[model samples]
Target: PGAVLDLSKVIQSFPGVLPKPSFGYAIAMRGGAPNENRYFIDGISIPTVSHFSIQGASGGAVSLVNLDHIQGMDLITGAFPTEVDDALSGVLLLEGRNGRKDRWGLRATQGGTDYGITFEGPIGENTTAVVS
Candidate 1:
């Protein structure tokens, strides 16, 4: 498990990306400001990726996305893509995993500062649900 369960922490390992100075959970890509970057989840744009985010800025003490549910992530810096607009720095795309279909499952997590329970199960023949 990561020091912090926030998914954003994963990006810090990537080259050319650095955590913004004096701002928790905020990232600066290729010297661009934090707000210049954009974040997307499954093709949908979200205002902020971190919890307790500041108004008119992005970054906080933690991330709102649960790492357990993430399937994959793509970080794009420089060379803007047509699908992602209005970004001057970078773009992060987060993909969530589908709930289990064969059977129901439950998972509980306890961290130094937080705890959570996740429930996933089949809703119907072809539908599944995941609640955290």
Candidate 2:
């Protein structure tokens, strides 16, 4: 994290956008502050990033979404719907997959502050249940 990120290199990854150095959150889209964004998981809002990361509280939480079960991500910058309010910047909409049709699987991970697990399998011939 020591090395400074080149603005030119970042811009190359996205078309028609520019990177401004002032917004230094570990994960920010464009030049917007973290507070200017929103995050949703499975149609529900996730309110915090770990217990209390200050910057996130001012903006919005960094999602703890697992890519393994993720089905979709939508980040909107300009002109949003009326259903969303209070955000001066953007919205990050995340959608996750239900689970496999008829198979069982388990995944786990741990850190000093948190630990998590996910289990998924079949409930019936055409039904499935996922626990996380």
Candidate 3:
């Protein structure tokens, strides 16, 4: 992969994040179990959101969501809101970008075993559509 964006690469390098190093990449954060953590996108919970999900808690080798479409993320390690009651370890929240209405935009990226293109623009005066 060339110029690929991987969340696991970043997480694996973090302090106190122990590595699994078996097939897939997984991390034990601050001595907590990997399964204790929770990951979310746009308020929706998913079974697995990574290409190497069975291996690493670092978000696998490839993220299921497109990096270019992410607007922001909320990572809470402790004392999360009551609504996020499932995790005693941590929360990784993601927000996706809304399509731009003013003008068309396109982006592409390739890395490791992943590559993709994204397109965004107005579908109508009051709506926008984003495709990846």
15-108, model 3: which lDDT tens digit per residue? 6556666555565666787767777878887644467666335446566666777788776777887888887666778788899989889989
Error of 1 at 132 (Å): 2.9
Residue range with the least summed lDDT across 10 consecutive positions in model 3? 1-10
Q: Which candidate number has the best TM-score?
A: 1
Per-residue lDDT for 39-126 in model 1, tens only? 8988999877878766556677776777677789989998878988799988988897899999999988766445667889999899
For all predicted structures, in order, the TM-scores are 0.88, 0.60, 0.78
Q: What is the alpha-carbon lDDT for the whole of candidate 1? A: 0.80
Candidates arranged by lDDT, highest first = 1, 3, 2
After TM-score superposition, what is the CA distance of residue 61 in candidate 2 from its true location, in Å? Answer: 11
Provide the clashing-pair count of each candidate structure.
Answer: 0, 1, 5
Q: How well does candidate 2 match the true structure in TM-score terms?
A: 0.60
Among all windows of 10 consecutive residues in model 1, the one with the lowest summed lDDT is 1-10
Candidate that beats the other on TM-score, 1 or 3, i.e. the better one: 1
Inter-residue clash pairs, candidate 2: 35-59
Alpha carbon lDDT of each predicted model = 0.80, 0.52, 0.69
Judge candidate 2 at residue 73 and give its lDDT: 62
Give RMSD to native, each candidate: 1.8, 6.6, 3.0
**Candidate 2: segments with Cα more than 4 A from true spot:** 1-30, 49-52, 55-63, 108-117
Across residues 63-120, which tens digit of lDDT does each residue of candidate 2 receive? Answer: 2444445566666666776767865665656677777785799987553333567898
Better of 1 and 2 by TM-score: 1
